[model samples]
Target chain A: MKARILVSFKDSVLDPQGQTVRNALHTLGYDAVQDVRQGKVFELDLSGISKAEAERLIPEIAGKVLANMVIEKYTWQILED
Target chain B: MKARILVSFKDSVLDPQGQTVRNALHTLGYDAVQDVRQGKVFELDLSGISKAEAERLIPEIAGKVLANMVIEKYTWQILED
Candidate 1:
């Protein structure tokens, strides 16, 4: 199975990278862009595991290693079988 | 409106960051993980633009700045009004 995890900053956190990108976009003439928030996506390929097991383990993996829970939020979904 | 851009390495490209993360996961006890790929997601907030306009502009922005077309691919969608 394959799974996808998305890790992003909490809404209250200031994202300097996002701000930098936003400014760059403006400089590049994309003035319609108001704000930008950057995040990460992790795609995992799994073997020797059933989909149910993967589903159970993904949250744990994401919490412990994929994201910093105090400042970032993570969401995940099974992508393929 | 809000738009999301997903930028990922092309399949043929080597991802050192993903490999490092995979190694870390294995060391951390997620042995079921076979491989990992990393990507970026950019969330954009736009004003004075219609969804249709955003849809039209996103591809241009992604291609020109958000992703390296030679070694990466990007997809985007409008998220909200």
Candidate 2:
């Protein structure tokens, strides 16, 4: 099975990288741009877990490797592929 | 209105950052970690545009400011306030 994960900083978090992207685009003359926040995407192939087990296991996976809960938050989806 | 944008490199893309994060996590002793792909998320407070207008505008926004189309792919969503 494969899963897709999205990881991001929580609301109160400071995102310098996002700011840089915003500035880069603004400098490139895309002035209509408002904000740019960046995050992570993960595609994974799993072994030894049924789809049922995957649903059960992923939250723990998020806590384990997908995110640093103290600073970031994440969401995941089991891909049909 | 607010919108969330997710940006990532295409599958054929070389993901050095992802590899670095994976190495970092491994060094930190998170061995169960597998693939660590990185992406970007954006949140924007859009003014003067209705919710409907936002939905229409975001794709262009992604194309213009959020990502470099030659190397990255992206998706976006409107946040419900």
Which window of 10 residues has the lowest lDDT sum in candidate 2 chain B?
A: B28-37
Q: Is the docking of candidate 2 incorrect, acceptable, medium or high quality?
A: acceptable
Report how closely model 1 matches the true complex, as a DockQ value: 0.87
Q: On residues A1-81, what C-alpha lDDT tens digit does candidate 1 reach at each position?
A: 899999999999999999999999999999999999999999999999998899899999999999999999999999889
Per-residue accuracy of model 1 over B1-81 as CA lDDT, tens digit each:
999899999999999999999999999989999999999999999999888888889999999999999999988888889
**TM-score of predicted structure 2:** 0.71
Docking class of 1: high
Kindly list the per-residue Cα lDDT of model 2 for residues A1-81, writing each as its tens digit.
Answer: 677777888868988887887788668755555776676677665556578877876676677866899999888998863
C-alpha lDDT of all candidate models, in order = 0.95, 0.75
Supply the DockQ value of model 2. Answer: 0.40
True contacts kept of 2: 0.49
